[model samples]
Target: MSSGSPLLADLIEALRCLPGVGGKSAQRMAFHLLERERERGLKLADTLHEAMQRIGHCTRCRNFSEEPMCTICSNASRDRHLLCVVESPVDLAAIEQATGYRGQYFVLMGRLSPLDGLGPQELGLDLLSERLGEGEIEEMILATNPTVEGEATAHYLAQLARAAGIKPTRLAHGVPLGGELEYVDRGTLAHAFGSRLSVD
Candidate 1:
């Protein structure tokens, strides 16, 4: 549905480019910006333009950065021998926030989904291989999500780590803490049961 103004319609269409923003959501955003938040909208536009122009992928970890290297990659205090592999930058942020992990990271950017045209090349496996071969990393943490594609990607990465003589470890998957087994889903419950640890 087009509004009387072509510019307003264009703005709504442009807003629809954001993830999870549909036609109605975009239209509401467009109207809100135009009617009440024009100054903030202009500021956002300027900031977005600047960020788009300045931010580029870090040469080391492939994370978004204003320079060739990201802060995490360049930090001297982080453990260089521990490399955590994640599917996306968002996952990396989550791990950083939730855990006291002080290790280097390698962002896959996307998992191996041949149907979606994301493969080893697109995920920068060559770069990862080169980094592994450097002999600096002692352990490779496979922190990819527990999805089908993520499992495949983690397996591939584990093989790569083994080939490079680096130890590969996967994140523990199971029922959440403080959750009862009856309330947990069957898949998660089964996984937790099968992978149970013995009490000392």
Candidate 2:
């Protein structure tokens, strides 16, 4: 890499910004984009730029959407009375794909990490409280990840739900500790949702 061309080195370093991609992977990606897939790489770059410019947080659920409300939040057929709270849009997508959850969702965007400056405000807990106080939602499903921060966030949200006179429940422990919903198998996630326990 020391002997590599400066432009090529820059491309490889830029690719390293991607998650789970290391030096070797970034180098390979850079080489592939330059040598064999220049057209596709350009298209990818353009698409990413467009998406970044257009996509914004959904006003109702905090998920990414082009409109104020996400499709799930605006769909009248969905159960508005049941709100499934998730850590991120990816987690919400996983649950939607795996289970028959016809209810609405609220994406926290992240779990509570006070040391990292992530707290109730960062997670939009105040907006969630406002939504709950509207008296439409009957229950809140805590589907945060199985990490320590996720657990603490779930506990905090459960208390918030109780204050709003809404029942709170959690996903079953079928989702292993430290496992993310996006990586969990569809069958496992379905089972976990089916066997969820009340957090009353």
Question: Could you list the CA RMSD of all candidates, in the order they appear?
Answer: 1.9, 6.4
Q: What TM-score would you give candidate 1 relative to the actual structure? A: 0.90
lDDT of each: 0.96, 0.92
Per-residue lDDT of candidate 2, residues 1-200 (tens digit)? 77459988887898898999999999889888888999999999999889989999999999999898889889999998899999998899899899999999999999999999999999999999999999999989999998889989999999999998999999876888799999999877997899898999
Stretches of candidate 1 off by over 4 Å are: 1-4
List TM-scores for all candidates, in order. Answer: 0.90, 0.79
Task: Sum up the clashes in candidate 1.
Answer: 0
lDDT by residue (142-192, candidate 1, tens digit) is: 999999999999999999999999999999989999998889999988998
The candidate maximizing TM-score is 1
**Residue 88 alpha-carbon offset, candidate 1, angstroms:** 1.1
lDDT of 1 at 186: 94
Give the Å shift of residue 19 in candidate 1.
1.9
Model 2 misplaced stretches (Cα beyond 4 Å):
2-6, 174-200
Candidate 2 achieves a global lDDT of 0.92
